[model samples]
Target: MRNKGPKIIILTASYGNGHLQVANSLYQECIRRGYDNVKICNLYTESHPFISEVTEKLYSKSFTYGKQFYKLFYYGTDFIQNKKMLRWYYQYGFKRLTSLIETEEPDILINTFPINAVPEFRRRTGIVIPTFNIITDYCLHSLWLHDDIDKYYVASNELKAKIHSRGVTESKVVVSGIPIRPSFSQSLDKSMLFDKYQISPKKDLILLIAGAHGVLKNIKETCETLLLKTDHQLAVVCGKNHSLRNEMAQLENKYRDRLHCFGYLERIDELYRIASVMVTKPGGITLTEATATGTPLILYMPVPGQEKENARFFSEKGAALTAKNQEELLNSIDSLLKSKQKQLSLQLSIKKLYLPSSQEMIMTDILKESEKISRMKNHSTIKSQKKKLGS
Candidate 1:
């Protein structure tokens, strides 16, 4: 039973953690469903190492220092005409990826990254594999569109309509919210989590996430504002940012037992469950996970391009509130903390947006598509053999 499902290869890049996170979610789902030969590949690092390294550095630098430049680059390649040049530049990656695909010979290919590797692979090797493109962001980018893809999993109906408007058939698009790790959708006992984190169950909890790279600007000021302005206890998760963790540690003494700072914890679901509200950047994966947990979010200074779009989508959906500056951040947090009605409204909105069974739906669709493709291939092969025999 474990080895019964099709061989799956999920291709993702490290331009941001969102893509890889989505890929990993799908990989985990496949394994959970007893798919034995599921493989996750980091396309950029495995197939194009030097390019991935340089682009990752540039990506970090752009977000940290040159956001305007990053936005410019994001929009520049978003046009169909510009995509030709972009594809030409990535010909080397295409070839390397095609070689890797030839070696693996997967039954299906799932791409969480922007690059349409499946189409390029078919163009080069003439192999037609069932392909799925899981768009990690709320909005659709032209780079994620590919004629050869059999299915597209989008975050919303608006995104599905947008893709349909771009000439992709409506049947090919599925409005499945971005798949998050299954743990986020699970129910955790609040008292247990409170005891585990050593926080008082009597007080409301505020969770602050500085993101995976720890790039939250003015985190100290934000923390101070939360402490001074609100009555709730603060839990700050500085993911992979040791320096930020160390800096946050000093506040423990001044604030006494109200402050909790952690570097990285695998069981983030527990924290999400205990916290009444979350303050973080609007990354696709983080937002999806928060929504899964029905935690209202205060999106702080999302980057110019995709993050802004994600923030806008969630804000419009009533799932989150956007805070562009410290004043807005403080005000938004204060408002949410004081108003139970607003908090409940946000929680309900998030519940509507979050698809708890997205992983299962995605896996079912992929398997169905793979079976269709396999049948077609077998039929074609049979026809060819019969024709040869008759001739």
Candidate 2:
């Protein structure tokens, strides 16, 4: 059934979780602003059940066999000779999603994932409503470049420039950072965060997150070396990796007070809030969140395609330090821990990278556009009524 109030349907995908994170942030901000008719849905689940199932199998394969396969798929985009596949997906995929839009007749539509953006644009023909694409990554992708897309909400000026380089109109891109959880914009008591996690504020705390599927091959060995060779306490978050969580729990028992292990945690913002340093791959969303919380980054084992590029961009800007292997990872961690000056410098760099109010910025843009459309419709209706009375 259609909602009685105005609706804005947010579409996201589950491949890496960044898109979903961006979508959720927009949802919360809209509701806070009294747009209670907003709804969130998984794009693949709703429109393409068979394709979603296949994508899940492919994701598991990449996670288990090797992430290089996923990298290969991302890199394989270079081979596309033209926009043939893009046009096909626009027709088939967008057709499947039209019913929801027709049923709700939303005032605005938001696309948080690139895979969903092109199709959305194609489906929007003859519709007067506004559409916006909130890109959740630092880099632009082929799937994100389309003339029909009205606005592009980007993470950084660098990405905005890159999107323009891909032949998009400069007027269409907005360099608003990726939307993050609203809690990130609020100031939190660091000590309270530490207390909540039962971590000591006196010692430097490190947060280690395995990517969605789990740790890099050398992460376990790296964790052991840090705990044994250095004084910094480590908290490892193995998200959705039951086996890795169990293994880390066994190790934590031996280390006692120094090591903490967690799985599928809800309060990740708290972890970032309390941590002095963070060790993880440079996923766009994770890095953005870490910056929001002012946590220093030690990026390790970045995958070879987009992640590698993300790591380079971060380290060059001094927001993070990169490690080539176990020895280097240990050395980098030790160096950061040993120097109070270095830690302070890193914190200052993180502050420079912060875009704390992106959720507000993106949502505000959407509302302004919707209001403009509403005013235009009202003016057009009055014109028609006047003409009918004169006739």
Candidate 3:
């Protein structure tokens, strides 16, 4: 039986990979559940290309070369949730997005980024579509909070409490966890995956991921440290960073049979399945995926704002270890790799935190609320007709 659900338009921005990953996950699950007319919009790219390019360049530079400026900018804007800025963005996005929305005639709008244009669209067009915000962080930023959002899907109970404290009603918040693709939750035969990847089935696999942009500092040092300090096979993913991939490729001759280098692999889940320990930055989606796979994490040099908070949350839960510099990174990896008991404990902690049904739960709630709204609108139409007839 096909589900009769409302048409959905998921709004996402590509500032980081996390937001787009969440949007894609939701989009895929909606299609699986028989949603016929679902579309995803990269709001920045489609509505404002020039601004998007400029901002993307700045974002990349900040993480790669301007760390101090980025930290200052992130912390400086954290508390200053100005509606004026939001209104400015609203005005700028209005003309481009309004026509698109008008043509799509979507029944619901879901935002994965903190783009505040949705409310403005509703205000300008006088359309009463339900809106949802899936916050892509472990901590709540004030920019994501708006009077117009009907529901919020958060990562944890702590985040739920924090949002509620910010005057959002408890009923409006759902602790659905972060949405990750279904592949991370599936059971895979480790031996089979190892064989397929041509990795040694007996040696412990150490996986290193440097996020989508591949801007992690000292990638060469990290790989060298793992190779020298432990008797493990190494796999590194240099995501979309050709220069970093080239740098890593040069090391293949030195490590020979022990090193596997990849550039922008679509099947990261397979790598996650075979690895016993993963060293990565604490981007929300990556952290969530690691937890889902029950891989122990050594968080390396997380960027200031939300990434720092994510690292703190995971470290406090005993699910991961945080390393501030190169020496600490090597020591953390050595500690985890040496003790199977310690690694299993961390994996158990991650297993406790993982929520595999978050996507399904979110979809269920959305459909139920959509049905209720439809009924209310029908009732109003009937009442108005009776009034016209009597008059």
Candidate 4:
């Protein structure tokens, strides 16, 4: 069922990297599946400048101050969403957003982040298009509540069921999993991957990842502790944080043989493929990538609200474990390194939890919906022409 019409647009924001990451993967998958008529747009930047700057600053603040500031914003949004005053704010926010959507005139819209959902609802007050909200996180928020959304692609059945509980129709929800890149779905031999990185397969591998903005508190201490006591190899990804990378260079030099540090890598899929365990903040994108690669997770210092829910959900499901303090982290690492059986169990659970081809599934549905809309448009046009001729 090939789509033979205008491009389908994927809208995302810079609040977190998860939205853009999912949009890019789906865009790539659309191209791979022979649909080049796909466009990925950062709606925040495309729609409004002042708002985007404020959003970027908020992201930077979260990374610098860590969890408390992030939670503050999250809670603030919750507070606003709970009140009626913000309804006008929401409407004003979407007015400019709708202007951008009208200009794009995309056949179908896939919103990777929730903020973009506002425009969809507002635009549908007088217009309609096939719209889908791809919930990037494992949890849903009030922003995702839109009557105009035709469908929802969510991370898990649990999230889908939860959305249903909130009065969303069950039939409209699809647990297609989070949209991850295709590389995460592939298998790599540990020995081969290690050889490529010049790492030793004999040593246990611990891959630590900071979130999109590289916002983990006490990272320096965490790295020092892991290097001092563990008989394991460590790969630390600093994401977009250049300062952290510069700081870690000295440590990398001291532990050059066992430690690997990277800054904003595009090929994180390879590292995930080889790692025995992943130490990361509980981000939907990172967790999905780890799960896709069948790597067990050691959840660390998650931001409150949605992130906390993600960490708790996956940990309680046995796909991962949460480490509250430094001692628990060290103990968790030691336990995993020594007990291959436990690692194997987590791996099995992660595999069971993952939806391997989620990116493809989501794209397929988007294109299908687009074609349906196009057909309806053509039929309506032809019907109007015939009526005019009869008159």
Query: For model 2, how does the per-residue alpha-carbon lDDT over 1-391 read when each residue is reduced to its tens digit?
Result: 5544468888788777778888999998887887779988786677778888788778656644767888887766634537766556556456546777767677777888765533454455655567678987676667766656668898778998888888888878888888887777677788787878789999989888886767455667777888888777889889888999887877899888999988887678888888878888788899898878888898886776667778888888888999877778778888888898898888889778878689898888777776886798789989999999999
lDDT of each: 0.84, 0.78, 0.84, 0.79
Report the Cα lDDT for residue 171, model 1.
93
Model 3 worst lDDT run, 10 consecutive residues: 85-94
lDDT of 3: 0.84
Q: Which pairs clash inside model 2?
A: none
- Top TM-score model: 1
The count of residue-pair clashes in candidate 1 stands at 0
Candidate 4 on 1-391: residue-level lDDT in tens?
A: 7665556778788877888889998888877777767888786676677878886887767645656877876777755545354565455347556676677666677888775445445455655667888998877776776667778999899999988987889988988999887777666776787888888888888988876677766677888888897668899889988898999999999999989989987778898888888888888898888877888889986668787888888988899989887788878988987899999999999888788789888878777776786688789889999999999
TM-score per candidate: 0.94, 0.89, 0.93, 0.89
RMSD of each: 2.0, 3.2, 2.5, 3.2
- Model 1 gets an lDDT of 0.84
Where in model 4 is the C-alpha error above 4 Å?
Answer: 1-4, 63-66, 75-84, 92-96, 116-125, 373-391
Which parts of model 1 are misplaced by more than 4 Å?
1-4, 89-92, 384-391
Distance from true position, residue 267, model 2, in Å? 2.1
